[model samples]
Each structure stands twice: as structure tokens, then as C-alpha cells.
Target: MPCDLEMGLDNNEDGNGSPETKKIGGVEEEDGDESVGLSRKMSEASICAAEDDEDEEGRKIELGPQCTLKEQLEKDKDDESLRRWKEQLLGSVDIAAVGETLEPEVKILSLAIRTPGRPDIVLQVPESGNPKGLWFTLKEGSRYSLIFTFQVSNNIVAGLKYANTVWKTGVKVDSSKEMLGTFSPQEEPYTHEMPEDTTPSGIFARGSYSARTKFVDDDDKCYLEINYTFDIRKDWQSS
Candidate 1:
């Protein structure tokens, strides 16, 4: 099938939305194991699935209270992409940024998000101090991509040594629910993980990774900080 793929490049070490997800292209995969390895293809399929559902008014249909057709489509897309990326891209794809040194203009950071959309939401960073965070309303069950990238000081490694998308949910936006999805870039170079469940209004994620630090030969600056740029898009319907 033909599909549209989104690609993003983030210079920040912080896991924030800096790993921006943008549609890159359309790829048609031949049926077989080879198709599984092509993330660009899988993402295309995901996008198509998302585009398939919409009411005449352009709003997503709802089968249940607080549930929308858009959300369901995203849930399916996440599952399909995660499975395909793991089976196909893990060994062959190359994200060479994890091991190389970044330039002086770049920064390092990580990403975390909370659900429930109010004072009930929270964001956390496992590698650094947690800062006052921002909130984006994710339609229940919709698919959201967390594009993760890193920077280094030396060209030791080409890209990310490891990248993971993990989730923890709760009955009250606390750590009490099940982990919906987890993807690790261990088998290959380029891959995408299925996002965790966000349909319950209490599920969120942590996009975390490490990279080579850029430093001077002799300088007092010993710490690294990453910047996150959030790109939130809402169409006429989503609004």
C-alpha cells in the first residue's frame, strides 16, 4: 500500500517535542518481511488510517462517551507502526546521532507528559531536574509521535545507542495503570515505537535517551541541557 511518512530532526538533547514529527514522504511496500523493516512505509500507512475516519462535519465520530473515531484510528496506527518498526527497522535503520558530539549551538534535554488535562496532569524527567511543564490536550486514543534525537561532542557513534518510548498510567494520573507500549532501538538503526495508551485520559509517556556531550577542552561548563520545541497542530475539525 502507498503511505505518507513523517520525519523530524531534533538538535536538542531534551526529550521535549524537539524531536519534531513531520510528514516526510509516501512509500509503497511490497508484501513480505522487507515491508516490515521500512518505517517510512509503516508511518505512511498509519497516516492513511488516521485520515480515513471523519464525520461529514469533519469531526471524528464517537462510539462511546469521550471516544472519537480519530482516537481509534490513532490507536491502530500506533500498534501497527510499533510492530513494523521492531521487526523491520531495528537492525537495519541507522540513527547515527546518539554517539556523535553536538555543536555549541545545540542543547540536551528529555521529554515527559501527563494526562487528565488539568491540575491532575504532571510531567517528569528521569535524567534531569523536572521543570514547570506545558500541557497539550491529546484527543482520547489519538496517536501522537514522539520524535527523539540527541547530540554529542565527538563523532564517536553515529546516532542513538538506545531510544525508548515508555508509558505508565493511573486511575488518577498517578503510576497505577498498565504499561501500554514500549519500543527500544536495539535491533536496528531506524525504528518507531507505538505510543502508550492515551485513551483513558490518564495515560502519558516519557521519551528518554542519552547522547554524546559537547564540551570544550578546558571550560568550567560541565553540565548539558536540552531544549524542547512543541509543535501542536489542530485542524478546523480538531478545534
Candidate 2:
């Protein structure tokens, strides 16, 4: 792969009529190119890993100082201008109703499955140790989506995230993570739907898949975790 001979650039001589490397502004030597290339690749990999860790360690990110919404709203009530601005920012959310709790409380009430041109199949979220198991089936190559209805109370939930991992026969097939942004306690539950995806179309891909999903905030406080199983079949499963 060395193109020095092809480009007629094999002249590894110095300016003093002695043997030296071509400087090309002296950024690096010809012999160090391989090392530089390897270092660049390693740096890129490190960046990718750091990005992944960033979601898990989001609470540690500094944003000056942190305070509850109640505290922030009460911080500077004397200044009418500032108070109005804060009111505009918080909107009609009643901070006084969030109570005196110090940490956020989140509840995922339901999970719904939606297929194009079909009614949504709403499923109740099961308890952690419920003796019963939750299951569903999807047709191969059929597009479907998942929706979560959740509520945040007590305080603001920062960097809310949803993570799901799928496995088939004990081997992980896919993993997905998404930041659901921050949420303040409100009277209404929040509904978020993930992008739709098609079931893989193949005999090997059609099988039972177990998935574990978790909802957590920046503090790593898990709001909910669910383990469920589903099947990808050749045809839509009848109710």
C-alpha cells in the first residue's frame, strides 16, 4: 500500500545532501504515519464509549447548581420582572402541589402496541414480581410501535431515559436507549411513543424474543423495569 514509489516520492533525503525525511511543514515524520493512524482510530472509539457513558452519568453533569422546581420558583419572588419570567417558563404548572418531597417519583402506567391501520392494543403494566407473564406476538415484516404512559411527581425528573434490551435464546439481539428529556410533576400523564420498526423477515429471525425495559432518570433512580416476551411469526397473531 505504500505509494511512495508510485508517486516518485521515495526521496528520503535531507536538505544538506544527506539522507532525511521530507518535512511537509514538519507536522510529523513519514515513519510516524502508522502510529498516528492507529492513535486516531483509538481516539474515535474512545469518543463513542464516552458518549454511551454520558447517558448513564447524566446526573453528574454540572449545570451550575441544582434545585427543585419549588425552590427555584421561590428563589427570587421579590423581583416582579424575574417572577413574571419564571412564571412564563413554568407556565400553569402548580409547583406548590408537588409537595415537599426531595426526589422525583415516576410511574409508568401502561404500554400500548400500535400497528398501522389497526387499533392500539393497550397492555397494563405488570408488577415486578407478578406470577403472571406478559406476552405478545407480531407478524414478520409488520411495522409496529410501542407507547408508554407515565407520570412524574414529587419533583422534576432530569434526563429521563428509556432503555430496552432484546434477546433470543439467551443472546442479545438489539439494545435501544433514548433520552425522554426532563419532566416536572403535573396532573396529566405523559405519553411517549417510540419510532416504528418492522419485524425482521426470515425463518431464523422469527422466534420468541425476551426483552427487558427500564425507565430511569439522571440520578439512576429506576422508575420502572419490565421483562416481557414476544414472538415474531409468519402471520398476525389472532387475539
List candidate 2 segments past 4 Å from native.
Answer: 1-66, 76-85, 129-131
Q: What is the lDDT, from 0 to 100, of the residue 34 in candidate 2?
A: 32
- Give the per-residue lDDT digits (tens) of candidate 2, residues 208-235: 7777777875555688877777777899
lDDT values for all models = 0.26, 0.57
Model 2 worst lDDT run, 10 consecutive residues: 1-10
lDDT by residue (tens digit), candidate 1, 1-239: 00000111221233332222322111223434333322222222222212233446777533222212122223335566645544342333233532222311212333333333433222233355323343233343333434222232221111121222212231111111111111222322222222333332222222221222221111112333322222223311133
Best by lDDT: 2
**In model 1, which runs have C-alpha deviations exceeding 4 angstroms?**
1-129, 133-136, 158-239
Candidate 2 lDDT score at position 20: 26
